[model samples]
Target: MKAVHFGAGNIGRGFVGLLLHEAGCEVVFSDVAESLVQQLQQADSFTVTTVGQHPTTTVVEGFRALNSDQDPETLTEEIASADIVTTAVGARILRFVAPSIAAGIAARPAGAPPLAVMACENAINATDLLEQEIRANYQGEDLEEKALFANTAVDRIVPVQAEGAGLDVTVEDFFEWAVERGPFGGNEPDVPGITWVDDLAPYIERKLFTVNTGHATTAWHGWAAGHATIAEAIRDPAVAIEVETVLAETSSLLSARHGFSEDDMASYRAKVLGRFANTALPDPVERVGRGPLRKLSREDRIIGPAAALAERGLEHEGLLSAVAAALAFTPEGDEEVDRLQDLLRTTSADAATLEITGLAPDHPLHPEVRALIAARITGP
Candidate 1:
């Protein structure tokens, strides 16, 4: 089998690409980074270490580079021949990668193999956005029927490699890749390499609420408590207390929404907590909390799933505090920091809160979210 994956970054080589090779597929990674592309071609393979006391190396092999810009035709051929295609390119660059994908679609000849384009991004409805971009390039039947996309949820804490930009990456062994149909408003399942289920909502919420929420909790509390890393942050009593509180709130939401039993939820939380405490990761506060604007978007991080759950009559105040902390995420010179700071400065706290959070002006939670932001700015 052959697979074509976008983004030759850590996620491409360390997570997905590594797994694909282990599953016996010859993988070709298409990337926009010129240096990264050269690195992959030169290395031919790289290693990913499990984040634990006994750090183990997982070798990812057989994948080479196909530059989308310099080798569009080469990229096109790979996609056309691919049994399945997957992407780990960051969400913001989806539009930039569309044309290369469109060219790939154009290159397919008669009896082309079935193709599935799964965007392994962190967005709530990532595949929805990715499919939209891919479809925008097609016309008529090709747009409607030529291909398929399966919305998926992926969770693996692969932090930015500290080894200074080679194919090598460090990641936690715990991973979740869940696929969905129907609510994606589509018919028929497409391709392989995913765990397709009828409802993606439950799975997505579970991961976002539990995993993403915990990671962010570590980041925010970690930063405020003066810890340089996630591992260190969890050691602080205040940070741990806050993270536990946030997880409880998230658990309530998940249990209400998914019918997950309390015992099961506890086990899940324990496992996640275990993952966060991973020593090999020692994830920096900056890495997890890097992009304030993106994480605070309507469809990402704590706010997105939290608000959605709240509308469904689930607990959200703890999440509201998280959103507030995200706003207080004042890392010097980070563009979103300036943007959020400006919003708070130029507008009323309530209005700035409403605008960034996508909350209704008169929404009951608006008051709570605003109060939380006020507390974060002034402290405890």
Candidate 2:
């Protein structure tokens, strides 16, 4: 079996690529970074270090890399013949990869076996969105017959590796990729470590609201509190309380929305906090909280649940507090932070809230965001 995986970054290699290799598939990495492509081409394999509890090392071999921009034709060929295709590119980069995927599908031999295309992004329904973009370019092709696009929710804490680690990805051992299997027509991909579900909503919301929400809350609060790393901040009693409080709000929403047992959700919350406190991972607060604008968007972690809860008249003050902390984050190196800061600095909080979160001015939660922004700027 062969897999064509996009994004040669840490999560791409450490989590997705490693699992694909272990599933007995030869992996072909497609990346736009020339330097990374050259590095992968030079080295036949790379190391994935699993941190936390029992630390272990796994060497991923029999893989190749192609520069998606410099060599699109070759990448298209690989994708055309791939047994499975997966993407770990950030949600924003989904469209850029779509054209290549479309060309691959267009060039594929008629009546060829179905190709499984799953996007392992952090966002909800990511592969569905990817397929939508691909269809825009590969019109007239019956994608349902040619490929299976599976929406997936991936959860893993692959921190920024130590500088000069040289292709060795350091990641936490805990990971999950819940995929929607209804579109597979009973011939799901043979990849291991994937939990296939008929309805992915419960799993997606569970992971998103718990893992992602908790991580972002810790990052934003931790950054505002001057803690540099997730482990350090999670260790602090105050930051930990904020994280738990936010998780409690999200848990309520998830339980009400998905019928999850309160006990199970509580267990999940505890496990997530333990993952954050994994000293071996050591994720920087700024890196985790880099994209403040996207994080605050209506469909994203913070405002998504908060807005939903507000509609149901449920408690969401914890989420609002985390949103305030995220607004205060202006990490030095992140370009998006500067953009977000400028927007808030120049415009009224209400205007910025509308533009950033995609919330209507008349939204029930709009006033809440405005109030939080005011509180955040004024302090206490």
Candidate 3:
């Protein structure tokens, strides 16, 4: 078996590529980073170190790399005959990669087994977004016959690599790659790392609301409290209290909407918090809190659950606090953070609230968000 995986970064190499290699598939990494692509092309192998309770290292080999920017034809050819195509690229990047995938699908010969494509991104239904982009780019008939797209929920914490750690990744031991089974018709890729589920919505929500939400909340609150790393922030009693409060609010929404048992959510919440507090990971607050605007979106980690909770007349103050902190995140290099700061400075409170969170004026959570933005704009 062969797989074409996009985004040869830490999550792609450490989690997704490692699992694909273990599944006995020859992995082809398609990346636009010239240096990274050249490194993979020249190197024989790389290591993935899983840190935490059971620390172990595995060497990944028998993989090929292509510079998707300079060698599109090669990548398209690789995708044409590939059995599986997966991406760890951010949700926003799927559009850029879609045309190549569409070209690959068009190049496939008749009667070929449908290529299984999954986007292992943090966002909800990321593969669906990829599929939409591919559909827009594809000119061939019977698009469904050429590719099978499955939405996935992936959870793995990959911290910034130490300097000079060439192609090597250090990630937390805990990882989950849950894929929807209904899309594959029982012929899912032979990836042992996957937990195939009949319904992926609950898993997606559970991970997004708990892991993503808690992680971002910790980062934002941690930044506000003058903390550096996630471990440091989560260990701080004040930050921890705020994060737990946000998780509690999201937990209630999950239980109320998804029918996830209270006990189950509590266990999940505890495990997630413990992961954040893992000193071994040392995820930086700036890195996690970089995309403040996206995190504050109406359907994203903070606002999504908060909006739902508000609609149900549930308490969402904790989430709103996180939102306020998110607005205060002003990291140096993040484009989103720069844009967010600009919006806050130049735009009106109501306009900025609607623009940032995509919340309508009549939304149940609108007034609170607007008020927060107004406070942020006016200052103390």
Candidate 4:
């Protein structure tokens, strides 16, 4: 078996690529980073260190690397004959990689088995977004026959690597890669890391609302409390209180909308918080809380659950508080933070709320979000 995995970053190498290598697939990493590609091409093997309760190191080998930007034809050819194609690229970059995948699909043999394509991104239904872009680029009518796109929910905490850690990755031990089973027709990929599910919506929302939402809440609130790392921030009593409140609100929404049991959500929430408190990870607040504008969008981690809860007349004050904290996240270097600060300074409260969160004037959450921005602008 062979797999073409995009991104080649920490998540890609540590999680997805490692799993693929274990599955007996020759993993070809397609990346645009020239240095990273060269390093992979030169190295015989790399190590993935899983930290936390059961710390262990595994060496992965028998992989190839390609510079997608420098050698599109070779990358396309590799994708053409691969059994699986996966991506850890952010949801926004899916479009840029779509054309290459489309070209590869077009080059496949007539009777070839459909290539299983999954985007292991933090966003909800990220593979659906990739499929849409692939469809636009594909000229042939048998797109479905050539490729299978499965939406996935991937959860793992891959912290920033220490300097000089070449292709090595340090990630938390706890991880989950849940993929939809509908696309595979009972013949899923031979990846032991995947948990095939009938309906991926619940898993997606559960991870997004709980993990993504809670992580962002911790980061934003941690930044507000003048903390650096997630471990330090989550350990702070005040930040922990705010984080728990936000999780409680999102937990209620998850149970109400997804039929997840209260007990189950409570256990999951506890486990997630424990993961955040893992001092071994040492994730920085600004790293997790970067891209504040994107995180604050209506369909994203913060606003998505909050908007749903508000529309249902449920408690969303905790989430709104997180929103306010996110707005105050002005870490230096993040373009989104700079943009957000500028947007708040230059635009009206109502306009900034709409532009930032994509909430219309009549949205149930609009007035509250507008009020938050208004307070930020004019002072509490």
TM-score of each: 0.88, 0.97, 0.98, 0.97
Across 226-294, the per-residue lDDT of candidate 1 in tens digits comes to 888888888788888878888888787778768998999899999988888877676888888877767
Query: What local lDDT score does residue 316 receive in model 4, on the 0 to 100 scale?
Result: 91
Stretches of candidate 4 exceeding 4 Å from the true structure: 378-380
C-alpha RMSD for every candidate = 3.5, 2.0, 1.4, 1.6
| Residue range 288-380, candidate 3, lDDT tens digits | 887888788878899899999989999999999999899888878899998888888888898888899999999899999999999877422
Q: What is the lDDT of residue 258 in candidate 2?
A: 89
**Stretches > 4 Å off in candidate 1:** 53-55, 181-194, 312-315, 346-351, 371-380
Model 2, span 1-380: residue lDDT tens: 99999998988899999999999999999999999999999997789988877889999999999999999889989988988999998888999999999888877788998888999988879898999999999865477788888899898899998989999999998988889989987888887788889999989888988888899889989988899999999998999999998899999999999898899999999899999999888899988887888788888888999999999998998998888888888789887788887776677776777878888978889898988765544311
Q: Candidate 1 vs. truth: CA RMSD? A: 3.5
lDDT (0 to 1) per candidate: 0.75, 0.88, 0.92, 0.92
Q: Which regions of candidate 3 deviate over 4 angstroms?
A: 378-380
Best by TM-score: 3
Candidate 1's displacement at residue 290, Å, is 1.7
